[model samples]
Target: MAEERQRIRVEFAYDGGPYHGWAKQPGLPTVQAALEDALAMIIRQPIATVVAGRTDAGVHANQQVVHADIPADIWATVPRNAPLAPAPAMLRRLNGVLAKDHPGIIVHQIQEVPRVFDARFSAVRREYSYQIADGLARWNPLYRHIRWQHREELNVEHMNIGAQDLLGLHDFLSFCRPRPHSTTIRTLEELSFSRLPDGAIKARIIADAFCHNMVRALIAACVQVGAGQRPPAWLGERLAAAERTSETKLAPAHGLVLEKVSYPSCEQWAARAEQTRARRDS
Candidate 1:
């Protein structure tokens, strides 16, 4: 009989500046490829991972999640002579490998999880933050990789007002790049803007799921209103249109970061995944 496999969940963070994206592609360095390569070295076999969110190139992640299945015997060999548990040993070894060749990625946690715990489908929500350094904010060259430097001064109040119109269930076609067989309908739980102490503007976006380019597109729309180029009401009109237009623009990918991915309790994992799958199928 084939050896039983154990499902493992890993929480990690990465600077996406050097990689193409999360998904592995031939002739391209990617977060997934780098991580899987590290895993394969330790396990002596190939491994694949399913991520919570497939962030685009130049988009960073403060905390990202993924799940992979490993053969039981291979997992048992992780801590050959060490006193550490398999999970902790695996984390240390993985980080050690990554540090040598892929220093931009770091593994925060690794644990054996229930078979039903899916990093992607079982997720309850994903939260993202976008940083903007407008004309009023002092330009910091050190943060160039993470902040969008805009020439125009932004009005935080106007951005907040425009963001309010995007809350709740809506077809965000105008704010999303269309993908084959994927729906643009998303329930935006929260969208807010605030000025940081450094005079830069920060946007916090929470949603059940976001389509291709959704977060950046939404930010671009709010930036327009905040810069006095459009009225706050224009956001609502864009949602109502349910179609992409020339006016739709995308904020720089470097300014965005995947902050977190929330999931239900252990007992609800399977149920949540089932529900999410059904909704997507419809």
Candidate 2:
């Protein structure tokens, strides 16, 4: 009989400062390239991985999700419950590969998942955050890479008011780079802004899916409102336009981070994927 295939899911985090985003590109470092290389070494064959989100260049992820398939022969030899107690030998081995070559990336957990689970299509929501170091926050070196340095003062209350207008289902074309062949409609579950204890502005957005540059674009629009350059009502006005707006600035990718991906119960994985794909494709 043919060797059975095992579908495995991995949760990991990476500092995007050195890599060129999550997807592999020619002549550039990428999270996917580094991961596939390590997997190839472990399985003794070429390997492919699917991610829940394709983060832009310079965008970090705290709990990025990925899924891969391997042959039973390869899976049988890898210990699933050894080498570090709960962390399987396979998981430790993969981390070893990451530490040696891709030190910025690390795998936290790995386990066999249902065959129907697809990291990208099966996801129900994605959470992202952006940091702006304005006011006195520019002096913090610890957040240099993850926080954008904005010189102008930002009103957190104003930003929050503008953010509330963006929460809900709408065609976010005004906040996304044009994707002519794809839909821009998305259900924004959450959009809020707060002043971090360190005086930095933290903006969080949650949505079913995002188009190119959407999160950063949304941040920029809200910043303009916070800076008193635009009225809080402008966001709703732009949403009604349903087209890309030249007035909105695109924020730097370095300040954005993919925080998490959520999904339904294992039994509903296939159904969720089906509905998500159908809507996304339409």
Candidate 3:
């Protein structure tokens, strides 16, 4: 009999310090490779996964979503009538194996979904936050992996002002690493900065999708403003310039976190995926 298949959505968290990135690569550690290997061992079949956000090396995620098609036979092993939901059982099994085999990753969510659920394309928006501690008050060595410790004096007010102009839909080519055959236009929904209780400055950015290095470049531009090297209007002018320039640097990847990915209701997942895959001009 042909193998039966059921689509499953999985959410997990990772430190990203011990692996390359979310994508699998030869001769290097990756989140996907580890998860796929564990799932294949449990299910007795090779498995592949699609992620909601493909984070860069050294980037962390509090809740990263993934989707995979598992063999129905393997999924049936979990108790269905013993008062344990298959979803939670699978979550536990996955986490159990992950904790034993992978030292830095954890699986948190798993649910059977309609076959139309595409983790990447179905996502409506993704939120990213960057932490920087220029004031020294929030620069703690304990969180060296999660936070950026910038010793420079940063004007938070100017950084916030510079970020405000980035709001709305625009072709953000000037801030993205160029990719062939990929459009640089994006709907930048939010870019706000606030002083945390720890005295660190954090930037929260939400967007439909981001081109490679877009967030870091935007942060670098804001940092320049915060450091008094650039004016508020300079960033807007760069947006209009529409070309990636050396003026904006790429912030360290370690400071960025994939906070979350929003999606439409389960009933509309297929439709939402379809809408996301369509090309955009505005």
Among these predictions, the greatest lDDT belongs to 1
Q: Write the per-residue lDDT of candidate 1 for residues 124-176, one digit (tens) a residue.
A: 99999999999944678888899999989988898898788899999999999
1 or 3, greater by lDDT: 1
- The TM-score leader among the candidates is 1
Q: Single out the weakest 10-residue window by summed lDDT for candidate 2.
A: 79-88
- CA lDDT, every prediction? 0.94, 0.88, 0.87
Residue-level lDDT for 175 in candidate 1: 95
lDDT at residue 174 of model 3 (Cα atoms): 88
Q: Can you write out model 2's per-residue Cα lDDT over 17-64, one digit (the tens) per residue?
A: 999999999999999999999989988999899999899899999999
lDDT of 3: 0.87
Model 1 stretches with alpha carbons more than 4 Å out: none
Candidate 3 lDDT over 1-282, as tens digits, reads: 777788999988888888888889999998999999988877777899999978889898898999999878768876545567777887877787888869689887898998999999899899999998885666899878877788787998988888888889999998988677778888999998888887888999999989888998999899989989989888899999998766768888899999998998988888888787776322
State residue 103's C-alpha deviation in candidate 2, in Å. Answer: 1.0
**Which residue pairs collide, candidate 3?**
none
Sort order, lDDT high to low? 1, 2, 3
Candidate 2 to truth, TM: 0.94
What order do candidates take by TM-score, descending?
Answer: 1, 2, 3
